[model samples]
Target: MPADDGERGAAALAQMRAMTADICDVIPLTAEDDFRITTATMMIGNALLVDSRVTDLEYDRTPAHIARGGLDHFHVTLCIEGEMWFSSGRRDVMVRAGDICLLDMGPPNRTVLRGGGGRTHLRAIILQRAMLAPRLAHPDAATAILLPAQHPHARLLANHFAALMLPPAPEAGSAEVTIEAIADIAAAAAGGTADIAAGVERAERHLYLAVIKRRIADNLETDALTVDELCRHFQISRATLYRLFETDGGLAHYVREQRLNLAFRQLISPAARETRLIDMAVNMRFSSDSTFIRAFRRKFGLTPGELRELADRWLRETGAVPAIDTVLHQLARRRKS
Candidate 1:
């Protein structure tokens, strides 16, 4: 949840800039004499909502920010009581009160928020790229798509956000459902959804996929990680399981990839550096040490042993361990390119 910065003038402006420096660059366009910012934030998992009333400012996600590698997310902003100009790629948009706009954080973009008098009310939701990209037919096509308040879906979405933000906030148990509802409405409003029902189903698919992924990670050492067994355990049909992992190629491939990832983490972790490859293979459910080595080499272009040694040298020289997820995400992006 967002907390109050509890400062004013130059102090508040500096605080606001620092708050968002990691994700985007914020430039205060308001005068320093009376610069002001207030916000309440709510987040569940990777779904984040910021209800902000702030002074005029320019928010920029530049090429440098993209290269720094944390832009795998999306933003849907509702202009409750403000005027703004937004641009990304070839499109530009003017957003006013009762209007909504979409921003793909993965791309370089700029938005100027003009509060008319150095104060504006805007609600923005940030979501992971993995969560929203699957729902977009052409992810880049809808950037800066404005959904006016008159649009039926936009009106309904506004109501949902308003209700969730009202007194007596929603419970933690309902966070997944809340995120699902928001995603469905925003995707539909952006013209990326086929229908309301399909949008709802797509959102639900991600919710369930997250749960299943957690289970997979928790039970990585189990023999029941196979497709058939997982289907049985989750009480889902084979086709359902396949569809859930369609983007990942297939259920079997997803599991194998996860196992390999987990194995890599184990090999490079200082605590597990002494763990033998054969034991790690068995723990990761590989049939044999040789099988694990070959698969690992094929996927990462390095044998497990070689990768471990490199990780050690890198840590020794830099005094910092390699972050496997960041490396893997970068590697994945490179392959796609």
Candidate 2:
């Protein structure tokens, strides 16, 4: 049966916490406002399909949380609407509508869904690691990346998730096939073998792109980083480099976005308060302070100074973190609008 926060009224948050305690820790970012969430789960064989619509929320899997919640499965989340920022220690990627991302349950990671709008709808298929591990060439390099939902294999998975919500749902036997297809697509996306032979090639290409991205991040601060340098370093042709980053608006755009994101984080750090804005810009390899400020505002809806002030205010107000039980209990007692 699907558990839901609807009709729980003041008890919604606690109910939500109870429902997901074994999966991940859910924290409402805008605790000052009503936290809304609706979830439906369907079991197919050994896998689970979870469809959820949520407002502003942050899902965290810290070492402490993982100790309490066993991590034995993986979640391949398909974004049906809205966007989320997902970060594993090594990478940060935005998953938006028509995008799919792999979240390794074993890793300590975080996902932030922005608010101030309608709920974000997502379909997460959870399967045990053993289900896909054997098929992967590099299983350890599989998580924290986005795969285009429009791709043939990914499209099949997306279509299946959509069909699961329609009237007169798939039969039990057919549901099993759907589950298999989802697993195959996920495996292929994560550099694993699948029923489709072409998936092997696609998986290798995806893995290659992951390596390229890591290399780019390593040299982001270098002013001379360019497509030519990347090609030489990776021993790949320029065409391959362009194709790999085409979805991100080319390598240059992706690099700039990454640099800007890093600068934004640094600007809000307590220790970075005394650092000059120009110094931050230069460190990111931005040509000038004005250019960096313009790019920052375009990427994050705020100037560096505004973000710093907001972070300071937020830190002062939040002080010490309360226990999860305490927070949920308080939230459960609050009246809902």
Highest TM-score: give the candidate number.
1
Model 1 stretches with alpha carbons more than 4 Å out: 2-6, 167-173, 193-337
lDDT of 2 by residue, 52-131 (tens): 88887898878877777567678888998888888877877898888888877776889899744877888898888888
- The per-residue C-alpha lDDT of model 2 at residue 143 equals 81
**In each prediction, how many residue pairs overlap at the backbone (N, C-alpha, C within less than 3 A)?**
1, 0
Please name the candidate that would achieve the greatest lDDT relative to the true structure.
Answer: 1
lDDT of 1 by residue, 135-204 (tens): 6767777588788877744654564566556443212225557676677766765665465546666655
Give the local distance difference test score of model 2.
0.71
Clashing pairs in 2: none
Q: Which ranges of candidate 2 are over 4 A from the true structure?
A: 2-10, 19-23, 166-173, 194-337
Candidates' TM-scores?
Answer: 0.54, 0.53
Model 2 clashes, total count? 0
Error of 2 at 150 (Å): 3.6
